[model samples]
Target: MKKRLVAVAFAASVASSFACAQTPVMFSSINLNAPHDNVVHGVRLAVLHGKVSEVKGVDFSLIGMSESDRTTGANFSIAFGANKINKEMTGVSLGWFNWNTGKATGANLGLANITHDVNGLNWSAVNYSTGTTVADVGLVSLSNKSTVQVGIFNKTKHIDAVQVGLVNCADNGFFKCFPIVNFPK
Candidate 1:
């Protein structure tokens, strides 16, 4: 019986050693509750802090001061935090200031939001996207090809859609600059 126990312990140690030797080791943080895994496949709560390489589930952070390579589920931050989803973002992200440096196919709600390629809704006080976006609703919205914009001031280069705001500017459209509403023909 004792021999069996010893053997099991030895095997466990050997396996752990091999796991640690891996290039990208994923494990919980030293502070028991916090986790710093290579990939988060479940809901994670960061009371003080936490981080992950990729998130496949919900991530709620309280003053979450960390970054993620990519996120498929929701990413929420209390104070002001950001992530660089270089690959893609397919879920909702809520924070005071949100920044998605990759392609986004979901929604972003915050005080300020920015993305490279936005294919979904962006609702904030100020929103900016380099690529075409489906919708932008904020106080000031700007995009290259925003399908719809509802804000105080809206600006876009190609508006194959509509803009409803105080001042709308479609750089290359029939109604290049209009008041209240603008559209391209």
Candidate 2:
């Protein structure tokens, strides 16, 4: 009996230590006491809102989702209140406005889309990328290095592909600016 009790206690202690090693799954509320770390490794549901430092898995928010550092999975916010990504975004962002302060590697569909560096499509009424390497489609598309753009008015500092719109401007191309179609050497 004594030996059996000691074995059980030792097993419990080892199990508890392993549990603490793994980051807990968080369910955030404005009223509950939950994990408030900068990093989350599992799923998170923020009812009516919350913020985090970094997320590695799925995250859902009612009003808004703000990542102070980086996000490597999907994030959705019902209302586009303040959806800001400071470092990097590698998934889909669906909102009224999607703002990526750092590198973006996914699609952004909204009324307005802005990013510092992008490698995917930006489909919106107004799309702006400081460093674009893929495509931007909008009423007004602007980028510093765009590969292709289809819009009403397209502007870029350099183009390695083509632009199809009413007014296309390739600042460093042969024509400097053109209408209908434009390309760069």
Candidate 3:
């Protein structure tokens, strides 16, 4: 049958060119270090340090450090720089230090912002989230489930929303520790 339809169209064109040569998309990438190219859709400029697995658009690192596994858009690091997203960061991380190990939806402006899970907003002078944090504006804010925490010092085990602090801790709230403001009463 015509040499089996030309060997099934040359085996579907060599399996679509080996799946398009395994994720090769680059619009711009200027890296000075570590293996660049697992995926980049556009714009990645890392001067001192760079590591990549995926970046959709715009990742700029100046003085040093920018790492990624998955980042959709916007990651800027400058002067004593650091930005690391190792699995998921949807957008926005401006840094003097910002880290994510998985699941960060948007906005982490940093002097140290760390995350495991954050839906949005962590403006930092040290804000840490080990799972579930919606907002933390910090001078030290830590979370396990904190919906809102504006801090001079705030800690949580579970606070559905609100802790404006001089010192506020919720080990299930209703005052496990409170000074300025703590909610869930």
Per-candidate RMSD, Å: 5.8, 4.9, 9.9
Which parts of model 2 are misplaced by more than 4 Å? 1-33, 46-49
Q: Give the TM-scores of the predictions, in the order they appear.
A: 0.76, 0.77, 0.39
Worst 10 residues of 2 by lDDT: 29-38
TM-score, structure 2 vs. true: 0.77
User: Candidates' lDDT values, in order?
Assistant: 0.76, 0.76, 0.82
Q: Residue 47 in model 2: shift from native, Å?
A: 6.3
Query: What clash count does candidate 3 reach?
Result: 0
- Which candidate has the highest lDDT of all? 3
lDDT tens readout by residue for model 2, 45-130: 66655566777877666565544368777766665543567888888766667788888888877788887787788888998887
Candidate 3: residue pairs that collide? none
Per-residue lDDT, model 3, residue 7, is 100
Clashing pairs in 2: none
Candidate 1 wrongly placed segments (more than 4 Å): 1-36, 46-51
Candidate 1 steric clashes = 0
Top candidate when judged by TM-score against the true structure: 2
